[model samples]
Target: MTPSLTEDGTLPAPAGNVIVVEESDMVDLFGVWDLVMVVSGVAWHLFTVVIFGWIVLRRHHFPPFRTRNLRLLGFMLACGILFWVCQVLTSLTTGRPNLPRAVCVLISPWLAYGLGLDLYMTILAYRLYLLYWLLVLRYPLRQSRRFYLFPILLGVPTALVLVSATASPRLVSTTHYPNPGNCVYSLMYSALCVVDVMIHIIVLLCLNYLCRHIEATYNDYRETTFGSIAFILLTIVAVNVFIWIGIGPPLYGYLFDREEYLAQFCVKLAADGLSCQGCHRRVDGSSSARLSYPPANPLHQHQYQRPTLPPGTGSYGETRPNDDNNSGQEDGRGTPGCSDSRTNGCRGGDDSLVEMAPTSRGITQQPADKNGHIEEWSLAHVAYHDDESNQLADKDYTGTSSAPHPPQHDRVIIE
Candidate 1:
């Protein structure tokens, strides 16, 4: 850090690994950089809160991946506030003076620095799970959100909190600085650096995975969204490389603590930003733009756009009420059912139509003008549509079926 203080007749330069100068002198030694870091952390938190609030107020869920999303982000923000509360309480009690080394160590916010950071990582982890499900499962959340995905999302961080609470006292410690009147905590002192690096590495891996998947799946994905994420990913990687600097021991190892905050801010920024990119956001970077989709509409709603007339079967692709050979019948609305066996458009009992799937963040819809019905789609619908729609049994007037029906019969009222 600061140039040798001994040269300026100040307290002799910090000697050895630990501060040899009296603890009281350490306060003035902290200097200005500490204030910059504190301010940066506070500012980022406020900015994230503002963004979170805007999303909540608008009832915008771009990806529509999960319900109560705004509620979930709100709860996370509230949990983060508790840490600031702890810091305030700690400051009020001791005022961070020439307290014994042991006293400050005991009072430094444990949950805030230790478990809290891990909790934030969970947000990034969700993105990873989103991609994994898409690549392998074909349909997101098809395996059972209640028994599997939901529990993992909620329980993993919860489990970490429990373990951290039990183990923190033994694994975490703090260094008190009088000048700034604060206690800087480290998880197990310097050793926690390794743990911190491990966490970031995992985050980096997740980002890398996300980028690769994005390239493969959303090759023509809106460039604005993809570019923003790519910038974030590159920025993080570059910063990490600069800090580590080479294949051996870091040439700039000392700067890690300084750069870590920036790196972390970027990571969380990417996560929060992704929450909005799933829907609405367009190539022009406008959320208010009219909804448009790529050729592969994820919900497979395009098939219902126009009822194609069967070859020489009939006009309007509809079997009249007096068709003597008619096997399929019509509903009161004159909508065709699978009763007509002459045409390939007719269904038997159960045939695949289109299945609604969750998006990355928000829900979208397209209106079938001729069909007089609106079809809903999610942001990540492109990743969802399949040749074989989820087979649904048809037993009632509103019942769904797997029967191969012509575009005319593909229409159904979504309830």
Candidate 2:
């Protein structure tokens, strides 16, 4: 049976007109501090919900509760709600104090008892996931499946022990007290917090190992994506540390004073929200920048033109023998023939036009050779013999050399 106290130091009339004496020692439940806690708690909870909704909407899946950051965020929101409930209960039980003190005293115990523990657990889960990933990634892709079984075996037992120890009814009552602020104390709760710290340490070490493994595996890719990701993770760790250090102990103090809880929650709401925003930058650059190169510099673009080569060369601009009539037989030793009709020195029209063939602006891809080898030959290698006089004069001498000059006397031919 619950005790209903009347301020007059006697039980109120059970059936007659009873004056329910309001104790001056007891404060009203609604006041400035409670108003702040309600506002801040409501705002943060909504912010978390909005972010979570965005994630789910973007991914079109159940919100990723398993991810480390997201999971921590969820836990924080949950803790906030739990703290709110505790404040409400305290208000109800302690003859309804003014808002701030009422809220603080009620929510303090839950915050002290479980909030940090929850965050610590979240970090541990994430770190363990990272460790598993590293172990899997360390081996060949085919053998990674062999490494996955260990997490389930280890994780289940650890979780079971933590949950069973904390959730016991006897343990729940020990951490709380009845003098306006109730707290339950049990080895389970204490052990849980200790485990949280230890696990967080382990996870932090695992994160270091995971990052080292990533650096080792992808030495080149580490500079760009890895740095960004590392910054985000480090930021998360920093924020976690701030909260662990900043909000943690104060929460215990607030368990005895509702006003303090509201104040702390309000301050935390601002600081942590700002920290989250700073930490959550998109990893990839903007979509437009990712898909396209930056605009070309107009001033620099005008400085260069495609170079021309001697006559009778392939599209790659390499000089071929006059007798090398097989225009399509581009082997691996040489570059692929240019397909642009403007550079028709081999079989098409004006050779001069080939030199002036408008270059592909964004990218110039080399065609594959006869053996399917693609060589990106520079534009300077192709020749242009658009002049009629040069064309007619070179047309009569078809021995092998594309140039009108005779073979050097020092050149030796064994064939």
Candidate 3:
């Protein structure tokens, strides 16, 4: 009769497929598939560890890695590296294909709770933060107080998932003692898996919203350096999902298959690199964009207008003059109660006139007012000097006002 295949290759009845075997028999039964599985799993774990280490070291060297989002990124990467290492090592020693079950049993409840689901949730949460900043806040992203929230949100859910996962026995081990550890397939573990899928979907949606927001805010405008980097990041996220969905399930059923696992590992590493690139791209791009424009100079752009009042203070001085009044009141000087003697010199329609004396022996005229002094280099002053010279020449021809008494007055040459 055909024998039942027990967890450790044991049989209930003596049959054609069954053979009396010890631990050595078990090792032989493991075969090529087992060796391949073990090697590939170990390699993948190692690769992840190396990648995570590199990320941490690089972040420390530079400051962008120090951001809250990036910090959470490090945590997630570290968790993934640790998770895979534990799962792969346990499977290799025991010669089993069901690693998730082994992980639930052997690994610390705290790590199992936080490391896996928490990290996965973070990817989505980070995306959501980006979305909220762009859409709701409508504020340009700079280093601000918003980054601190990441660790708290990430930690809470991870702790809960771990607690729930460990609370159920079926999620960790399927069979009782005397049987080789049975790789469990249970509801709690399945829930964790579902969470993974849902979080990914949320991340994708957030990315979509981000793209749309960018389009709306910067429509027809030239794309910034940050824009390009953000696009690359989005591309990487997309690629990550594609690869995980394509390769993840195949490896689950056939963990003993070495070639397939290695392929998955390679894909995962590439995806992680993409994620790092995305983050740095955004950070560097933002910095570059920030430093791109020089501070605006009002002097260079236009003639400097003296600050008369606070910003947005209405132009209170621009109203047209009322002609009915004898005294020019509302020309930013004399009004109802206030008196201004300067208006006497500014007679007739000419607002530019300033009476000055020819300071000489016989010619006795009042000195020019220091308060109404115009700059010698000014265009108005230069024009007035020329016009005054012409007027003096005309007066001489008409025999009206006599020329200055040069003998009596030592003329101070106006240089």
Q: Which predicted model would earn the best TM-score?
A: 3
Q: Where does model 1 exceed 4 Å of error?
A: 1-44, 59-110, 134-136, 139-170, 173-193, 196-200, 203-415
lDDT string, candidate 3, 130-246, tens digits: 656655668667776666565465455455656665666655563332234435547767677567546554554554455454443432113323554796899999879889888
* Worst window of 10 by summed lDDT in candidate 3: 393-402
Global lDDT of each model?
A: 0.41, 0.41, 0.40
Which prediction has more favorable TM-score, 1 or 2? 1
For 1-415, candidate 1 gives per-residue lDDT tens digits of 6666566688664554554435565434333755665677688888998887777766475655233255555655765665665554454544344444345444442455443544544543444455545554456566666436542644443455345534554433334333233344454544553455366446546544554545534322243357558979999998887566563232232245423332222223322333323222222343211221221434533322222334533322433333344425554323343343443544312232322222222223344345544332222222111123333432211222122222321211111
What TM-score against the true fold does each predicted structure earn? 0.33, 0.31, 0.34
| Angstrom error at residue 65, model 1 | 11
| Selected candidate, larger lDDT, 1 vs 3 | 1
Instruction: Give the lDDT ranking, best first.
Output: 1, 2, 3
Q: Supply candidate 1's per-residue lDDT for 233.
A: 100
